[model samples]
Target: MDPVTFSPPLYKQRYQFVIDLVKKYKPKKVVDLGCADCTLLWKLKFQTCIEVLAGVDINRAVITDKMYRLSPLPCEYLQPSERPLTIKLYQGSVAEKDPCTLGFDLASCIELIEHLETPVLEKFSEMVFGYMTPAIVIISTPNAEFNRLLPGLNGFRHKDHKFEWTKEEFQNWAQDVCSSYNYTVEFTGVGKGPPGTEDVGFCTQCGVFTRSYQSEGSLTADSCRDTEHSYKPIYNVVYPNLCDGTILRNTVISEVIYWAESIRKNMVECAQEDETVDNHSYQASSKSVPSVSNISQETCSTEEHVLTDTRGDNEAYKEGNTIFIPLAKLFSFSKVQKLCSSLDHLKAILSETSQVELNSDATAMILSAVEDIEEHAEACWDTSCLELGVALAECEEDWDEELCDS
Candidate 1:
């Protein structure tokens, strides 16, 4: 569970820019996404003149009871009645919707997106733009183009990164998210590259999104005004990385591992249940138990077959909506891919072989269900989950006939 080390200059520049943004848009409530170890907030609370600071990260180990017992610091500007700076720390995934009720003025997720897979990244964006809806959101990720400048840099910036995007890919994604959320985006890069490639030279790229909305009670385009600039940075923090040589664990990849383990545990339980049933039947049959040699051989063969079939079934039943074992193990990252593939294959089979005869309304419902499954697969990554698809398909009685004939 070692944390990955980041380039000092890369992080320093990123933090400085974030601090500048805070100073420009002095927000009262500040939140940091993927705030591993809460070190970033520690620096901010100590160095900046912020009224409130909160850090949220998925790492559960660092957020101890002692960490939450933050000591209050003296405030010179306090009106003998005002409380000092308030600090809150949460342990949860940034990719998921934030559980806190309080909204934030500024949210920062520094060098965290690359670690997430595509589906998780989409959810992360939705959480930021749709749920939190902060006035300003700052996100940073490694600029894949700059890897050439670093002589020792290997495949990716970190071992945990699922994929790295070029400048164009990152900008395209940012533009789409901003447009969907009514925000304007500005891009900046950190680190030096070749002299001529200023735009793509930075080892890390950051995007600043400011929310823009139309005037209250006015729907006209002319009435819309940019309001994000009203917020200014209240704090200027400068601190070197001061933690011990502890490598940050990749929560993103660990999530996948945890998922796989859960699936395996369920499969094991299912197998044990089946074995118990078999044992009961054998005992009731009025026959003595098998010899030790026979029992050992039988146990070995059954276990070997179960293990072999579990893996083989996943690969072999790729086109089916149901499988003997957990469907999630069929795909590398998410189950949605497998579901999509199965749906597409089902469509092709129907088109080439036989077709279900249904009324217009029933056909519409079936088609709508297909679309729903696609979106559901993407959001939940539920693999081999075709309950909706099958239910909708069965709405037309002719489907059963057509399927049997095919």
Candidate 2:
């Protein structure tokens, strides 16, 4: 079959969502499940610095063609031009394959769910989540409600699609499936625009499942009470926007954490046995002890508590733990800033010389950090500034007290 072509608007929106998710996870490897023509994989390989991109599909024809095309090149070959992205293609059902064996940080199943049977769907979820343990998984399908909205004359039905679900149905199913495998699900789509907007119509339903946790056990009998009886008009109900690009925020954060952790690990590994003592003596001689005030003691304490909480629970870590230790706590901001500055300086020097050395690890690390910074910055924007408001009020109170004393 010819590859399914998406409308430009729809394809771009979906691609953005996937890119955000990938950046958030910053997975070393990525796989596209049921990748018909492997076009997505090809695009992703060209776009991201992910170590590997594997495309899997059951179609023998696509796989045979891909193999024939790629076989001429060695197993790994550098492009004649400076191409940053790379991908490999495979042939198999997700239900039958292990993504971990293939080494994927993320797996995508765009427009593949509706074609699956329940048992196969369960198997497919298990195969990916159990083995790959990717930080993120993205899936998209047609929104059934939008299909209903289509005139019957549109003839949009596919012979292979066993079922099409409305947003509600898709959300519930995604939640259930993800939860079964200890994953959190977020719903997005081509309609609406983002998560919560006024526009609601036929658009592709997109679901993102992440290996993250939130506080639980808050629900109570009283919480179940529904007092509002009057029905609101459909116009009053705000239709949630589909993926609004923020989906990439999490990917960015994950990448940052990954890079930060990696850098810390490398530094620790390289440190001399007496380096800490030597540094301490040097600081003492200089009479300039580094102050801890720059770091949030509270945040550090919270992270430590979380680590302690997980110490005995190996299963919990495997499930998904988002409680990350901020790099600021582990490393001096001044040192990090200096390092970044030095890197920038080096880049300029390399450009001047026209002799750019490709440090894949360093490049990946920097990209991850950039993504993380962007993700958290966006998150901070979304939250109301109630704490800031309280702080301002307290400042006013202190000012009044100072004036009275004066």
Candidate 3:
């Protein structure tokens, strides 16, 4: 069978169920036993709460074949979570005991248990619940009762499945594991059956086991003893992150402040132009100069400019050594507003960033206390750093006003 016959695709639904649990549990260390193609690890890596992500499969060739897909994408380089993401893929078996796989907060065995021989299940259970003993374990397998509903599925869902179990049998096995390992178990499933088929439950059955007692002989935090290693490490990746606050202080904060000052300057120029128009003494500058950045003078303000080019003659803002690029301003340009269509998004970034101080309304920002940002900026400024956008400015302002008021 192609395995893509089910609605929403059965594999995808299984992965989504695990992802939902991950978001709720917020596990720090996660491992997937029998992680064949590693599609689950790829999805799990995006969850910020997972500090360490591991995948183990019996076939070295099978796991290594998908390693390239795990490489970080280009955009992930620019923006990463506060916690560094570490992903490791291993070549091993669920039935084997590996010390290196111990102490995971969550362990998964998606559509893998039925593939093991009946006798091997003992070893699999012992290795997972007894030895590695993660705080939580999720095991999913095809529900034999739902097989009659699948269009072309034969004797079993897959040829590799050594044996399939009914819901009662699966639940009995799960209860045995829980009893043996001192873990609590809950049974749930995904993929709805046809209208009158509710009695059999979902197409895929899953069991979630949570540790009820601490494992005996748990390794000390500073233990010098080296535990045994069994799984062969295939690939590892450490993503660039904002944990150190340097990127937030340097690139994000500096760019925001630079744009905020530019907005203030433009607002002042617009007011002056209003005064000049009223007095009938307005004079267009001798030379028409374009802006230093892509955002033209017309785009930054609602009013028109007809006097001396007041924006520092299109000069880049520089202080001492660092030349702050107006990336925020560039993003707000009419040509590129899609990148930053609303200033509220920018405000959210500023509000969440560590070492960044925002006034009660988030109109003003303080960054001097941060290590890499300017120390002199510890004092609050009088300008609203993020009050404008391009075409979406008005909607953004309304949203910001409502959000900030709360």
Candidate 4:
């Protein structure tokens, strides 16, 4: 049978609905109960509000193969996360009580309930809503009522689905679970039918169950940090954040190098324009010095933060194949407004790191044996920031593979 596809696609719509909930409630800890291929877990990692992310699936092979997709991207370093985010993928059954997946703020089961047998479903209800008892529970299942709207369909949507609950059946089951677990539920769905098919509801039915912790003395996240150790470790990674000294040093130095490289490219362009007006203005053989024209003098040189060469003084200088970039010019480069929000924030971070230091007057940022990026650009723009590019690439490659053994 051909796979059933929706306008936005049923799975995408379902994941988006959950992402919207995550944005609204800002849950710090979230776990996907039946993360088959980990597509949902991969998407949730981009949501910065979630600090602790986890995925539990019975299919260990799939989790192990796809877990690398959850790692931090290279751009994440240019602007680090405000809060640290750690992601873990576990191999386990949702029916069993697992300490590794416990005490989450939000629990998600997307199109997973219908796949469970009746006996397993009962256990899942108790384990997820009763023992774990997260503040919010989101569950989505295929709506049997909407099956008629699908083309060339049969008894169930998928052969693996033991049963598909009708709207009443799903809601009644939800209400019963809420009543048993002391929680309230909100009903919603994704994928609309034809204009007049409102009565049948969406293609995928969802229930958002919320409850406030009572006097039963629920488990705090720290309580189950280790205890039976129910879920088997698959992969785990902690993203680089500013709170650590070494990570901060690496992050700051890389940012400064890239920033300086970008400004150097612009400087080369301005120097070319200045060299056009006066043939003898710049002598690369003597030292890196470029004369400034009236337009440059009025617009850039007098800005106090832009490069200065109007009076024959070089804003950037070369000595024995080493070059220095003025911190004032780099931090105030007109183009950097798009790259950084607050230059002061970078300055503070730099001061905290010992790897890179400012000159005595704090006027220049001295990088040792820095090759001319202009030469690297002769190959391509990609090679211009070689030092930073290699650093970031090495870091990302570490996260590109499975982080845990078995």
| 2 versus 3: better TM-score goes to | 3
lDDT of 4 by residue, 109-226 (tens): 9999999999999999998998788889999999999999887787898999989999999999999998898999999899988777899998999999998555254666666654
Off by over 4 Å in 3: 1-5, 215-217, 221-226, 245-406
TM-score of every candidate: 0.47, 0.45, 0.63, 0.69
Among these predicted structures, which one has the highest TM-score?
4
Q: What C-alpha lDDT values do all the predictions have?
A: 0.56, 0.52, 0.70, 0.75
Per-candidate Cα RMSD to the true structure, in Å, reads 25.2, 27.2, 15.0, 8.1
Candidate 2: 10-residue stretch with minimal lDDT? 233-242
The true-structure Cα RMSD of candidate 4 reads 8.1
Q: What is the lDDT of residue 300 in candidate 3?
A: 56
Q: Which lDDT tens digits does candidate 3 get at residues 1-406?
A: 3233567888899999999999999999999888888899989888979989889998988888877788777566445456877788777778877666877899999999999998899999998888778889999998999888776777987888998899999999999999998999999999887677799898999999999987665644433145455667676666655553433333454455555455445544665787888555323432353433665667655443433245443333333333333334434544234323466655666776653455467644432221333332332221212311121255446655744553
Report the candidate with higher lDDT, 1 versus 2. 1
lDDT of 1 at 129: 80
Ranking by lDDT: 4, 3, 1, 2
Better of 1 and 4 by lDDT: 4
Q: Write candidate 2's Cα lDDT for 1-406 as tens digits.
A: 2223345666667677777777776776787777776556555654445756667777757655544332213212111112223345544677764322334557788888888998998787777765455667899998766554434525345788878887788888877877676898877776443334334544788878887643242222333232221111110001111111221222223233434445544434444445878788777866564764656889999987896786542121111212223233322334333333444532333233211122333221221222344354344433312333354356457656744553
Q: How many clashes in each structure?
A: 15, 15, 0, 0
